[model samples]
Target: MKEKITYQDAGVDVKTGYEAVKKMKKYVEATKTPGVLSELGSFGGLFQLDLKGYKQPILVSGTDGVGTKLKIAFMMEKHNTVGIDLVAMCANDVLCQGARPLFFLDYIGTGKLDSNQAAQIVEGVAKGCKEANCALIGGETAEMPGFYEKGEYDLAGFCVGIVDKDQIITGKDIQPGDVLMGLPSSGLHSNGFSLVRKLFFEKEKIKVEQYLKELGDTLGNILLTPTRIYVKVILDLLERFSIKGLAHITGGGFIENIPRILPEGCRAYIDTDSFPIPSIFTLIEQLGRLEKKDLYHTFNMGIGMIIVVDPKEVDPITKFLENKGEEVYEIGKVGRGEKGVEL
Candidate 1:
């Protein structure tokens, strides 16, 4: 028989993946909060939910992945911020229901794990958890030599949150005349990179490292920028007021995610002129030839987290987030319509 080269022989590394887990344990522990019951290597994450503070306690869970945006991270070889993206993708979703994240777990699978690369990934996850005030309880790192091409990896995150049953914000209270407020986004938060890649690399004929004033970095760097985690800011406001709805702008942007939280007869009309969208979106739209509609449907367009509140509460909510250094804007208003978002 001719000599055979196995999958491992094709440069898929195994031990390196486990080593990455070992390397990131410290940073993971740094993000631990009150609910964590087990350490990183456990088969299952353990969390204890305390109901002492409320008459009825409810558990909330959300799961999400980094999508093809990982391709951008891979192309750029920048692995630090996506962990935050993974955390935000899930934690922010739970926040939409007005829950406080209690703990988070993640799954990372790769063709081969370079200890250094895996460490960077978990380090990012841990950093995100700490920023959102959730416990980094546990996670898994899988090394399947044949499953992925060498140097390719994927991330999926799971999170659990807690809220008093009566306090959950499910948009049930939304009505006409409720104000729509916007919190600006840092950049593209883990979605639409497939289109972004096509625009910058395939269509625009640009290199990843080419600098642009709008992005303030190489194309790859801008694409790899981390998703912003809005858990802390909104959770803070949850304590002081009753919010009608919360929408975390993600893959569907305002056009889709916003509608999910709107009541059956209520719709959101966003004012495109309200907030100053970052230069990156303008650059992409002008250079990539993307339509204004598709741009709002695909990307956050600089507004990441949207807070919908009753008209009476708008001033307090605005002043509260503003005091916290948030750039808040009166972006739109809720009105009676078929369930949808309008610009």
Candidate 2:
């Protein structure tokens, strides 16, 4: 008799994937935000967006993924924190336009469904949505057996936000002489990890749990610290400060992100000495013999979000973020002629 072959034999069991969602439905409902109408297991997830208030409301949406940082999570056997990274990646971009995050969705693809491990990630997503003042409306988890190696997974997120047309933040309002306030990051915050992993694992041969003084924890512990959510904090600061623009420092770090907010004929003159470089960044530099320019261009190096504001609002804006237990710095001043960020 001929042997029978099936998708299950290749390891792509649709039933297992459906079962994973069944397990997550209860946990997901607990994080339900108001407008979420339908339950999981349906042909398509339903989300009702209600904008009962505001004149000239504009919808802002952003999609992003956690990048190869997932590899570290797999190696460390830590899956949860990356969920926050997923939300933060998308939410921060939407917030940059001064949009208030309204809802979030995530896509998690894995080789196989590990209910317990996957739930940990979903829980962190719920937590992140709350932190960003958004609803965990819905998400998708696919068990694509042949696509990924066993124990490997990938994460991506989508965020929807709203902002009044008049209140939208664009670099056009950001003129030369505007002050740039930098918000300190939680550490790395989901960028440049491919370089980090290469440096530590391949070059230095350091284990995830190995403790280093600068990072103040095992390598895995520090790197796993969830990305910081700047939405809630910046939303509140908008009232007191004429926030001309915002820059979320991620992959390209200062070199790329800061330039995004500069108006034509204007540049950012950053005072490198303005803020003390965090110990963790310093540690990476020393260990890797990383060049100064590479450090700033590759990692947050300190700043996570750069707030471009009128010079007049600097004092109060600094006080506001500082009061929230955030370390805010006057990293630079907007200047003309350079057309980009100058350190």
Candidate 3:
């Protein structure tokens, strides 16, 4: 008689997946807000819309992945913080639209299931959700044995947020004389890793643990820094300041992202010497022999979020952000001309 095959034989272990979910319950529940109506193990996550604060509420949603930054995590064998990167990637985008993050869901897929590692990753997600003041409602743990290489996993997150329709920051008000305030990033912030990996590992042949004096941290730790979530800061600023525009600098760096929020016949003239750029970016530039423009067009280069406010509000807003523990830079100003960025 031919042997019968079980689902487990096909590499899908229902039992192990259940155990992993069971372990992640506490972390998920810890991120629950008053709006979350479903438990962690439900088929779908539920969030009750809160309409108290707005006359016209609009839902804003964004989805993003950690990019090749995951490769660094795989190299370092550290899965904890990448989950935060996943959340930040989505949460910050919606924030650019003046949305208050409501709840987040994640999708994780791997070749093999490692329950402990899975739990660590979820805990990071939960921590990120809590930091952003959003609930962690649901996620998928897909174990495809042969599809991914052993011990490799990819993560993506979906975030839903709400904003008052009238309060949406479309940058329509951004005009000449608006000052651009830059908020510092916590390292690379989950973008441009494809080039980063090539420069550090393939070209430079550097090991994860190898220490560089300029970096002040090992290559592994520097690469794994969690992407910063700007939800709270943006929300707070929206309440107090007349922010003309907001830009979350990601994949295409300053050049690509800032243009997204600019109105017609306006340009951003950034003084490159205005802020203290972290050393990691300089290291990459030197090692790769990349031009100055390419360096600014790729990495965060220090600033993570940019705020365009009236020139008069620059001093007070800068002071307010400084008091709130943000590293603020008066990096540039809006000028009349082309609708692009200049540095």
TM-score of each: 0.94, 0.95, 0.98
Task: Assess the local accuracy of residue 50 in candidate 1 as a C-alpha lDDT between 0 and 100.
Answer: 74
Q: List the candidate 3 regions with Cα displacement exceeding 4 Å.
A: none
lDDT winner between 2 and 3, please give it.
3
Best by lDDT: 3
lDDT of 1 by residue, 193-263 (tens): 88887888888888888898777787777777788899888988888987889999999888989988887
What is the Å distance of residue 337 in model 1 from its true position? Answer: 1.9
Per-residue lDDT tens digits of candidate 3, residues 187-286? 9999899999999999999999898898998999998999999888889989998988889999999999999999999999999999998999989988
- Cα error, candidate 2, residue 267 (Å): 0.4
**Stretches of model 2 off by over 4 angstroms after superposition:** 1-3
Candidates 2 and 3, the one with greater TM-score? 3
Error of 1 at 322 (Å): 1.8
State, as a TM-score between 0 and 1, how close model 3 is to the true structure: 0.98
**N/CA/C clash count, model 2:** 0
TM accuracy, model 2 = 0.95
**What local lDDT score does residue 190 receive in model 2, on the 0 to 100 scale?**
92
